[model samples]
Target: MTRRTVRIAMNGVTGRMGYRQHLVRSILAIREQGGLDLGDGEVVWPEPVLVGRRAHALEELAERHGLTEWSTDLDAVLADDSVEIYFDAQVTSARVEAIKKAIAAGKHVYTEKPTATDVEGALDLARLARDAGIKHGVVQDKIFLPGLRKLKRLIDGGFFGEILSVRGEFGYWVFEGDWQAAQRPSWNYRAEDGGGIVVDMFPHWEYVLHELFGQVTSVTAHVRTHVPQRWDEQGKPYEATADDAAYGIFELAGGAVAQINSSWTVRVNRDELVEFQVDGTHGSAVAGLRNCRVQHRSSTPKPVWNPDLPVTESFRDQWQEIPDNQEFDNGFKAQWELFLRHVVQGAPYTWDLLAGARGVQLAELGLKSSAEGRRFDIPELTL
Candidate 1:
C-alpha cells in the first residue's frame, strides 16, 4: 500500500473551536486512526502545521500533542512549497485577508463561516478561489450530525411524505460574564468584532434548511440585544452592541416554511440544545443533536383539548425512537476526511466557497429583513 502525506497549514489553533474540535477531535483523531484508508491499497496521511498569533500557546499545544510543526509567521508558512492546504479558524474579521493570501499562494483552502463578515466579502473569496483553481470548502457540520443524518435518511425513504413545514429551536443561556464568566468570548456580543446571533448562526440555518428541506426563498426576522451589557475576558464591563437573539421565519422553495428561534439569553427546556420538528402529510419527526423520534399518521395518537379538564395523555410517549443502524463519527472529523479525499483523490465535493457565500448572503438578508421589519426575497448567487 502506498501512503501519501498531505501537509496542511491550520491557523487559529489557540482559539476554542480551533483547539478542541478541529485540532484535537478531527485532525489528530485522523492521525491516531493511522490515517484515512482510501481503499484500493492507498492511504492518505495528514500533517498539520499549527499556526496562530500566540507563540507560547502554539508551542504548548505542539508539545502536548507531539506535533513538530508550529508557526507564528503565516507568510513564512505559506511560502513553503510543501504546504498544499491552508485551513483557517481565525476570528471572522481576520479570515478574508488570510484566505486571500492562501489563494495567492496557490494552496487548497478550508475555513469556518461566516467566510466573511458580509456577502460581498464572501463572494469575493469565492471568486478568488475559483480563479486560483484551488480546492476550497467551508465547515457545514450540522448536516453530518447523527440526528440530521437519520432525518435525511427518513426524508430519502419518503417517510415524511409531501413535507409540509419545519420548526427549529436552538439556543441556551450564555452567562453575562459577571458572576459567571461568559461561556462565549466577549467578542461574540460585539458588532464591531463581527459578532451577533444573526451573523453567527444564520449561515448554519441557510445550509441546513437548504439541504434538508428546500432552498430558502424569503426571510422575516426580529433581532434583539437581550443582554445590553456584559463583562469581557478581563472581567471588565462593555456595552453589548450586537443582537443576542433572533426569531426568524424562513420560506422555502417547496412551499414549506421553517421557523427557527436562535438566542443566547434563553434557558434550555428541550431534550437537546438544538432540535428540529419536521411535519409532513404522513409522519412527523423531532430531531436533536444525537436523537430523533417520529410519529406517523397511522399510529399517531389523537388528543382532545379541553379547558375544563387536566391533560391525561403523555404527548412525548406517542413518538417512536429511530435506532442507530451504524456508528457515527464526529461531524467535524467526517468532513475533514471528505475534504482530504477531495484534495488527494479528486473526489466530488459540492460544498465549495460559492456555497459558503450563499450562507453569508442569507445572514445579510436576514439582518436587513429585521432592520426593515419586512420579509426579503433571497436572490440567487453566482460566481
Candidate 2:
C-alpha cells in the first residue's frame, strides 16, 4: 500500500470553531481512524501543525490530542517547503492578509467564510489563487448536513413539484452575559471584530438557495441590533455595534421567493435552533439540523379558522420524519475529507474561491438592501 501524507498548517485553531470542528472533529478524527482510504491500495494521511498566537494553548491542545506539531510562528510555517496547505479559521478581519501571504508563499489555501468583509476583497483573493495556480476552497458546511441532504434528495426526486417558496428561521437567544455567560463569543456582537448576522449567516443562505431552488436575483432586508449591551469574556460590559437580527426576502432566478429570519437574541420555539420550510404545489417539507419532516398534497391536513374553538388538532403530527438510509459524519469532516481528496488526487471539487466570493457578494448586497430599505439585485460576479 502507498501512503501519501499532506502537511497542513492550521492557523487560529485556538478559537471555538477552529478548535472543535477543524482540529479535533476533523483532522484529528481522520488521523484516529487510520487515515482515509483512496482505493487501489492508496491512502491519504493528514499531518496538522497547529498555528495560533498562544504557544502555551497550542502546546496544551497538541498534548491533549496526542499531536506532535504545534507552533505560534505562522510566517515560518507558511514558508516551509514541506507544508502543502495553509488553512485559516481566524477572525474574518484577519483572513484576507493571511490568505494573501499564504498564496504568495506558494501554498494551497482553504478557509471558512465569509471570505472577506467585502465583495472586492473576496474576488481579489480568488484572483490571487487563480493567478498562482494553487488549489483553493471555502467551507460551505451546511449542505452536507443530514437534514439538508435529505432535503436535497427530495428535491432531486421531484417531490416538491414546482417549488414555490422557502422560509428559513435561524438563531437562538445568547445570554446577555450579566448573570449567565454568553454562549457565543463576544466578537460576534462587535462590528469592529467583523460581527454581524447578515455577513455571518446570509452567506449560508445564498448557497443553500442557489444550490437547491435557484440563484438569488434580488434581496430586501431590514437589519437591527436588538440587545445593544452585552458582557464580554472578562466580565466587561460593552456596546454591541453590530446587527443581531436580519429579516430578508430574496427573489430567486426561477421566480421563487425565499424569506429568511436570523437573530441572535430570539427565543427558540421550533424543533431545532435552525430550520427551513419549503412549500410547493405538490408538497411541503421542513428540515432542521438533523431531522426533516414532510407532508404531501395528499396527506396535508385541512383546518378551519375559528376564534371561539379550542383548536385541538395536532398540527405538527401531520408531517412524517424522513428515515436515515445512510451513515452520516460531521458536516465539517465531510468537507475536509473531500478537500483532502481534491489535494491528493484529481477530484471533482467545485466549491472554489470564486464560489466563496459569491457568498461575500450576497452579504454585501444584503447590507445594502437593509440600509436603503429597498431591494437590491444580485449580479453574477466575474473574475
Candidate 3:
C-alpha cells in the first residue's frame, strides 16, 4: 500500500470547538484509525501543523496530542511547501484574513462558518478560491448528524407527502460569568467582536433548512439581548452588546415554512440542546442531536379540544422511535473524512466556499431583517 502524508496548517486549535471537535475528535481520530484509505493501494494520512496566536497554548496542545509541529507564526507555517491544506477554527473576526493568506499561499482551505462576518467577504473568499483553483469547503456538520440522517432517510423515501413546516428550538441558559463561568467565550456576547446569536446560529439554520428542506427565499426575524450585563472570562463586568436571542421565520422555495428560535437565555426542557420538529401532510418527525422520533397521520390519535378538562392522552408516547440501523460516526469527524477524501481523491463535494457564502448571507440578512422590522427576500448568490 502506498501511504502519502498531507500536511495541514490548522489555525486556532486553542478555542473550544477547535480543540475538542476539530483537533481531538476529527483530525486526531482519523490519525488514530491509521489514515483514510483512498483505495487502489493508496492511503492519505493527515499531518497537522498546529498554528495559533499563543505559542504556549499551541505548544501545550501539540505536546498533549503527541504532535511534533507547532508554530505561532502563521506566515511561516503557510510558507512551508509541504503544508497542502489550511483549516481555520479561529474566531469569526480573524477567519477572513487568515483564510485569504492561506488561499494566496496556494493551499486547499476548509473552515468553520459563518466563513466571514458579512456576505461580501464570504463571496470574496469563494471567488478567490475559485480563481486560485484551490479546493475549499466549510464545516456543515449538522447534516451528518445521526438524527438528521434519519430524517433525511424519511424524506427521501417519500414519507412526507407534502412538507408544510419546520420548527426548531436551540439553546440553553449560558450562565452569567458572575455566578458561574460562562460555557461560551466572552467574545460571543460582543457585537464589535463579531458575537451574537444571529451571527452564530442563523448560518446553521440556513444550511440545515436549505439542505433538508428547500432554498430560503425570505426571512423575518426579531432579535434581542436578553442578558444585558454579564461577566467576562476575567470575571469583570461587561455590557453584552450582542443579541443573545433570535426568533426567525424562513420561507422556503417549495412553500415550506421554517420557524427557528435561537437563544442563550432559554432553559432546556426538551430531549436535546437542539431539536427540530418537521410537520408534513402525511407524517411528522422530531429530530435532535442524537435521537429521532416520528408519527404517521394514520397512527395519530384524535383528541377533542377540552380546555376545561384535564388532558389524559400521553402525547409524547404517540411517536415511534427511529432505530439506528447502522453505525454512526461523530458528525464532525464524518464531514472531516469527506473533506479529506475530496481533497485526496478528487471526489465531488458540494459543500464549498460558495455554500459557505450562502450561510453568511443568511446570517447577514437575518440581522438586517431584525433591525429593520421587516422581512427580506433572499437574493441568489454566485461566485
Candidate 4:
C-alpha cells in the first residue's frame, strides 16, 4: 500500500482555539516533533492549508508555521483536489453549515464539539456524513486527560467496586474582558451565537460519564446566567443571554447517580480546572486534572460535621499521588493524534458524530428539564 499523507484544510484558523489549541499545539508542534508515532508501521502528520477571512492574518499564520498554502476562500480550499480532509474549529453556531458544505464537497470532516446547536441539526449532519461515505468525528478531549485516564484505569480495574455516586466540580473565573480581557471568545456569552455552558460542556460530561461509570439515562438541571452583562474584546458591554453556570443531576444506566457543577464564576482553589470524586461500596477515588488519590474500604473515614468543632479530616492522609507513567501531552493534541491514526491506520475512534449528537441531545434535554422544572429522560439516537 502507498503511504498517504493527509492534507487538511483548516477553517477558522484565525480564531482563538483554532490558532492556539488546534493549529499551534496540535498541528505545528506535532509536525515539528516528526509526526505522531502510531507504534507500528503507520505514522500520521497533518499538512494543513490555513483558511480564514483575513489575508494578512492567514498569511502570517502560514509563515509562522512554515505552511506555503493559505487561502481566504473556504470554497476554493474545498474545491482543491489536494485537500482530502476539512477540519473546522469555528464557533458552535457556524460549525454545522460549514461541515455540511465540506461533506457536500466530498471531504472528510473533523470538527470541534457541539457539532450543532441542537439535536436535530447534529443528527442531520451525522446522517449526511454517513450517506456521503465520509469519515466524520468530533473533538472529545476530556477522556484523554491524564487524571481522567487514571480514574478510568482504576474503575476498569475494579478499584471503585459497585460505584454509588460521582461528583464533578468544574469552574474558573472568566475575566470580564473589560478588566483583564476574556480568556474565551466574546461570542461564548451570547445566546444568538449558541454560546452557553450547557451546550458547550454537556458533551464533555456525556463522554466522561459514559467512560467512567455508565451512560446517562436521565438528567435534571438548573441553568443560570450569573453575570447579566460582559464586555467584548473592544470593551463594548453586551447583554449576556446565555447560561454561565449549570447544576445537573445525572442518573446513570447502572443505578449510580452523578452530579456536575459547571460554572464560569468560581475561583479555582484547587490544583486544576476540573476534579471528580467517585464513591463506591468498596472504595473511592479523587481525581484532578493531573493527579488522583484512592481510598479503599479499609481506609474509609467516619466523621461528624460540626461548625463549633474542628473540621473532620476525610481521606487526606490516605491520599496517594498518581505517578506520571507517560509523556505529557495536551488533551486536544492527544485527540488529534488519535483521529489521525483512525484515518491513516484504521484505529478505533469512538468520538464519532453519533457520540457528538448524543451530547447535544443531553444538552437539549437539560434545557427542557430546566424549563419544565422536572427530570427528563434522554432519548436514544436512532442513527
Provide the overall lDDT of each model, using Cα atoms, as 2-decimal numbers: 0.95, 0.93, 0.94, 0.88
Measured over all alpha carbons after superposition, the RMSD of each candidate to the real structure, in angstroms, is 0.6, 0.8, 0.7, 1.8
lDDT of 4 by residue, 88-194 (tens): 98888888988999999999889988999999999999999999998878988888888988898898888877999999999999988887889888889999999
Model 1, residue 313: distance off in Å is: 1.1
| Candidate 3 displacement at residue 341 in angstroms | 0.9
Per-residue lDDT tens digits for candidate 2, residues 206-230, read 8899888999999999999999999
For model 2, the stretches where C-alpha displacement exceeds 4 angstroms are none
What TM-score do all the candidates reach, one by one?
Answer: 0.99, 0.99, 0.99, 0.95
Q: What is the lDDT of residue 116 in candidate 4?
A: 95
How high is the lDDT of residue 70 in model 4? 91
Over 4 Å off in model 4, which ranges?
A: 1-3, 38-42, 312-315
Question: Which number leads on lDDT?
Answer: 1
Question: Model 3 TM-score?
Answer: 0.99
Clashing pairs counted in every model:
0, 0, 0, 0
lDDT of 3 by residue, 102-154 (tens): 99999999999989999999999999999999999999999999999999999
Ranking by lDDT: 1, 3, 2, 4
